[model samples]
Target: MAVTKRVVLHFPRRLVEQPVIYRLVKDYNLEFNILRASITAEPEEEGLLVLQLKGEQEEYDRGVKFLLKSGLKIQSLSQDVTRNEARCTSCGACVTLCPPGAFVVDPKTRQVNFDDEKCVACGLCIKACPPRAMEVHF
Candidate 1:
């Protein structure tokens, strides 16, 4: 069976410039989709990448092991972002700032819908929301 997972990866300063992501595809037979990344040429700070990985369960596990061995911190995507419907006004303010289109306005009800699966936890929506509805955990 195939498995897909979304995870936040933290790269140590020393490993920030490595070709590990390429290895995940070529060596592990895993597909990598980088949703968001913060990397710099300097090795002064740890870099972060939010990625979606897809492959067989075994291959995914192996790839995760490889990441762990390389001193990368892995975090699950669950609880990364949330929306309070009671506090939301469907103002569509967050729709423009969300890079992944996680927030959408329902055509029929004209209400805003929050899709957690599509959220990359970039935290831009939280500030864009006028009612302060979007909350980011990480």
Candidate 2:
């Protein structure tokens, strides 16, 4: 099983507007679960912004590289995932569409549960959902 991890990045308020974050998402496909992030200022230490990122291992490493290349400061990093479990109607839509087999339908209850570890964050299941239940977390 792949272990999920969280990475927190701290940056100056000026660096936050550099548009590098978008580039990372577009280029490397960084999956981010934002927990707590904001730009704050103090009397002595102003113009500082904090960003927290939670995602898979690959995303974490790439995000670090993206931040480093952009000249942003790294604050903290930890292993964690803020998962969003969605209800599955068991219409076999997710089963057929989910390439990673992240979704599984219970034979007894007809309910479906999605495993984030197994998921590659593909959006195919989202389109295949008849009830619009499956949501891809980035």
Candidate 3:
């Protein structure tokens, strides 16, 4: 039987919207539905982003593993702030480097706003960061 379960992915403030998540979905052939996702905290630059998801058991387990291997910090819905606020200096490295366009720079404020819905939680930004600002919330 295909058992379905509710899962919430608490993405770190950084690298929330990247290609790693999509890759996991496609690679595992998992059926997923996003329940809720947002920056749900203050100082968007240094806050926690929440991603609520529902999917099959096997697929979901694989998805969780995939996310872990990809370097994303995962947290159940019950646990909040699994990771810490990112101290990115808006270096613009992740902006162009992110394939899914997860990192965007505000030319006006030069602050980076990580969109969790768009993020796949790939660690490219984490590796690319010179200041080591991006944190993975697992």
Which candidate tops TM-score?
1
Encode model 3's per-residue lDDT on 26-105: one tens digit a residue. 77665565544555444354323344444566777888887777566666543321223456666677788876687777
Which of candidates 1 and 3 reaches a greater TM-score? 1
User: What is the overall TM-score of model 3 with all chains considered together?
Assistant: 0.42
Which of 1 and 3 is the better model by lDDT?
Answer: 1
Please give the lDDT score for candidate 3.
0.59
- For all predicted structures, in order, the TM-scores are 0.77, 0.41, 0.42
Candidate 2 per-residue lDDT over residues 1-138, each given as its tens digit: 233544446565567567766775676666455544556564343233323444556766776787787777664432122223444446677786777687778789886766655554445767677877665332
Off by over 4 Å in 3: 1-86
What is the C-alpha local distance difference test score of each model? Answer: 0.86, 0.56, 0.59
lDDT of 2 at 9: 60
Question: Candidate 1: minimum summed lDDT over ten consecutive residues — where?
Answer: 36-45
True-structure RMSD, every candidate: 2.8, 9.9, 13.7
**What lDDT is reached at residue 56 by model 2?**
58
Model 2, stretches more than 4 Å misplaced?
1-3, 41-60, 79-138
In terms of lDDT, the best-performing candidate is 1
List the candidate numbers ranked by lDDT, top first. Answer: 1, 3, 2
